[model samples]
Target: MRRPLLPPTLALVFALWPSTGCHLLLDGEPAAGIGAPCEQDSQCQAAQCIDEVCASPCSTSAECPAPATCTMAGLCQLPLRAAFVHVGDPATEQWTQAHEIGRQAAHEALPYLQTEIATNKLLASDAASAIDDFVARGFPVIIATSPTLRDVAALKSAEHPGVKFLTCGARSSATSNNIAYSGRMYQAAYLAGFAAARRSATDRLGMVASLPTPSVVRYINAFTTGARRASPAALVEVRWIGFWHDTLPPDAQGKTRERVLTEALLASGCDVIAHQADNGIPVATVAAASLTAKAIGNNVEDACRDDATSCLGATYFRWGPLYTQLLDGIHRSRWPAATLVELGMTLNPAHSTVNFTLNAGSGSSELAIEISNLLQELAAEGGETVPFLGPLCSTGQRDLDADGTPDCLDPGQAPDPQELQRMCWFVEGLVEKQDPADPTSEDRPALVPTTGDCAR
Candidate 1:
């Protein structure tokens, strides 16, 4: 079992230098400027365009790191501040990337911010208490991650409206100082699907997901949708482990189950596989499998040392730019509690919040290079890369409009913001359909003895 954190860890007191780039921002959001569409990834100032937006990379500091500020023009360079506090540890792959590494990356860009990194038990009350402690200590910007903290975060934000609070995986009312935002991973996931599909020998692809929520739903749908678009006849298979960051039980069982799922997929003839869960067990599984197959990682950009050089890279983020944006908003224009910001990817190399990386070694192959180039083109601005929209089918039960009737989307239609955020259905093109009534169909629980589990 992981040991409890004894004290607040002040990870570092580093200075930040702004990322060098020119960007266009509208009310602090990335916008395409009058510049000609970028011809390649490196041509852009902000290393973004992962979403095909031919604009400056970031709209705010959350996209870049601290000490680095994102200007209204979408540049991440003016010096910036505390004011930031991150709660969570690196014990689990998901938490590590989301909190540990996320903090470091954000700070690297926003160097002026005096940030605090704290870890508590995997419980909401504990998280809330930690935030309370930080609030007492005068940390005005509190970035609280973890499902356990979602509800309490809303309450705490209300209790201390003077404080800037942020939450993930859930929404806060639009009337408070608290705001919620999520990574638009589906955009990158679609690219991964397309890459995996192109490399498949059997046209069978397997994916291991974290949970059944809309985020995971979007990831799965985008992936399969992209795979099908590329391979045409490829089959996308999926499995789940029943929770997010299952660090309870403190045993290898959770990990073992994750691997078994991969083995089962491979055994069933999947030649290319992807894993989108938090702990990144799939990286190890896909890397270690004796069978030769293409593997993809999600969420974290860095290669796993345990499986160095084995992965095709991963879909990653730079929360510093985005977080930096939130801080600026709070200091300048106070946000009502329930603000929502949905950021997509751009093709800037250093500043893209979302990026697709392939192993340098594997990328040398003609096919690997081909996949890499294809991703670049697809992610390039002004391309036909809407993997989640139109001519779709639903793999899970869905009620997009919430009318008395539920329906699968037909051709010429797409899942809207509500549908995507709610993520009640999967896009068409799975190897097999699943029961909407299945317990594992939606929401997973945590491993520890928590008061609530997303457990279906």
Candidate 2:
């Protein structure tokens, strides 16, 4: 329920700046480069002409002109000196990839921002130490992108009241001077669901989630709901891989839960699948090779160089606007202490919401357009109410528990955050097991609405 804190005075300043002119710098310095125009690499000393601008060579501290340092990529980049830490399981290349999008955007939007990536192993000691290291480094804004990092962020926010924290897939009530939470991801996930529904061949789908946390739950529910609305015949199976990290050893029961569940769903005739396998490349490749099924791409798909026919399309999360907006706030010296920012489908031409990559040699432009239109309509409805709600039932026969009234309607009476965090049961029509030995089980129940509830 976090709201935007945009003051009228600050809004006016934002209105005046050219749409693309909001860049954050330490002392009003330009982000790209300094000095007069140049045409070639050798036009200026220690500077290369990139895109017609004279910029310094980048590789390391020595490569940079002054004050700037070299990063892990061997690029001479502006040193924000402010540590932007993203904590998640790097093993799941997908989550890592999604966060990388935000990191790249932040780096480009605010030239002074430095970043660090950490993996959460669920060990309390490791989590505590990670927070300590970030604070010790004097990182101003620490972005926790995973559920496991939520408690860590909260604990650290209390200890270091001067540092600012932002979480992506999780939320917390830690409204300390140094901590703020935002859940704009529901918008992204909803869009992803829309994309999945469009590409489904059987109108039967599946979702593999990392954990039952609020962030993941909301995404799963929203996706299934969206799919049902778009294609009532579409059945979405929801599964949980209890662990966020994708590379965990199979539970001692000798059953790789995620793999087993996924195989089961494929055996049961699901054509399209979307899962929170942070490292979706492997899963996508496997699904493509194993089940003759199609995969809905996410962050990693943008950088995919492979010829994956199963990759029908992907849902991309563009964090550039948010970063640019925050940087603008900081530069104008009017940054709000505690604010919630939501970036969805807007008039900004730079934002990329859902990207549909057609199968090679398949003329599917018409289909893609149809899908895009549906997504836009759903997005227009906003996040307060998901597309799937009425007459809902899970395969488990868990009553579509509404007290004779839909849970989404009736303002201020929505499901509590705690309920969302603990969501485990799948909606009706899915064919996944409730208990699986593998912590990363992919088996899930398909979600469908009751007759007369979903749009035809």
Candidate 3:
């Protein structure tokens, strides 16, 4: 059927209307897409728009126009189909904290998109299956929570080259799609130790741990360093429970494993206790119920808020904003291959991925204020002045660098990130203990078991 012709003015307006969407041209307005601003995904030619600016994905800077450089994810905007995977229930502390934070971030940042939290028991096979489901759904970005999923993440990365697998507590820093994401918890640990030392009446700090990986080792060593700085007589003791968590009960000795270790440390006059496992509740409980001991716990967002007086402060994990960046890359369709995110307060405490929260109490009263000032110094000037300086001595009073000079004397010798991550040595002040022989020889061990997580 032929349509009737419009008047001259109406005909001119129709000719100038945007072809992308059936909308009449507005006065002094540029059309959506084709290098123009956009409000949402539906308004762009690329089906992706962020921050009121349309992203044009490209490989090289030359391909991107001025003021828009090629991002780390290789895209101009974040991806749409982003999902988070965890081994534990969403309510669990360390294993599922990312799920809670991810949900919050998605609601605010990617509200138009539906973000999923795929929960599983997280054995090797289960991890593989979870990745398969996400891949089938065409999710370009996956943020894995538990360290137990490392091997599974690697295998799936090989299977699906397009997926970006960002993980916390990863065992390795592989340069492939299995991106490594870690917060400088040692920086926070240093603050926690100083706080503990200030609170300790016995001048001792103890740690109940699951594994002795470099990450864990770094935490213990940094705590020891900070504690010593606060109190010259301060000492640190560590005991690993033979696993990452309290997954197993004790033998015929009526030991819950944790009870046994806590009793032993307290008997030895250890006044402050910390745990490196998932939830900080147990640590808080142990400290509150103890006779003279206090607690320094982690993942406090999930554990310590209820009982503020049980211990000193919590070494909080800040993964939400970090996880948001991974989603941003996924939406932009440009995941970088070999990126390692090592965030610290030195970058900006207001925006740091980790920190300590010590409420005022007689145990940690003015010490918390002192530690806060120390943190400001630690975070200043790129944070090179961290406590594990060289001319540094090891557990046996031997020079850590194996040279005649110590870190304190050298001034140029401080443990760097990789050095701290690979540290297996204890500092000078810690008491000699029955840990793995030659700790320096084995800085990082298997973060998870090969057949664990019910892998059939």
Best by TM-score: 3
1 against 2, candidate with superior TM-score = 1
- CA deviation > 4 Å runs, candidate 1: 1-88, 91-95, 172-174, 248-255, 331-338, 363-386, 399-406, 432-456
lDDT score, candidate 3: 0.61
What TM-score fits each model? Answer: 0.70, 0.66, 0.74
**TM-score of candidate 3 against the unseen true structure:** 0.74
Q: Candidate 1: lDDT of 419?
A: 50
After aligning candidate 3 to the native by TM-score, how far in Å is the CA of 37 from where it should be? 9.6
User: Using lDDT as the measure, what is the rank order of every candidate, best first?
Assistant: 3, 1, 2
Judged by lDDT, which candidate is best? 3
Clashes of each: 44, 25, 18
Q: What is the C-alpha RMSD of each candidate to the true structure, in Å?
A: 13.0, 10.0, 12.4
Supply the global lDDT for candidate 2.
0.51
Give the TM-score comparing model 1 with the true structure, all chains together.
0.70
lDDT of each: 0.58, 0.51, 0.61
Tens digits of per-residue lDDT, candidate 3, 1-456, equal 112211121111111112222112233333224233456666666434545445555676565444344555454332255667778775665646644764575456443244677785567787777779988987766767777777778777777866667776675645366777777788888888888888888886777766656677677778887898889888776766766666775658855676667666665667888777765544645654685677776864435556566666777766655555555434333344445666665434435567777754634346655876887877775444466776666653224466765334255477666666566556766663434343333222122112232121
Worst 10 residues of 1 by lDDT: 4-13
Summarize candidate 1's per-residue lDDT along 62-120 as a digit string, tens digits: 76543345655464442322433334446655544555665666555433345766665
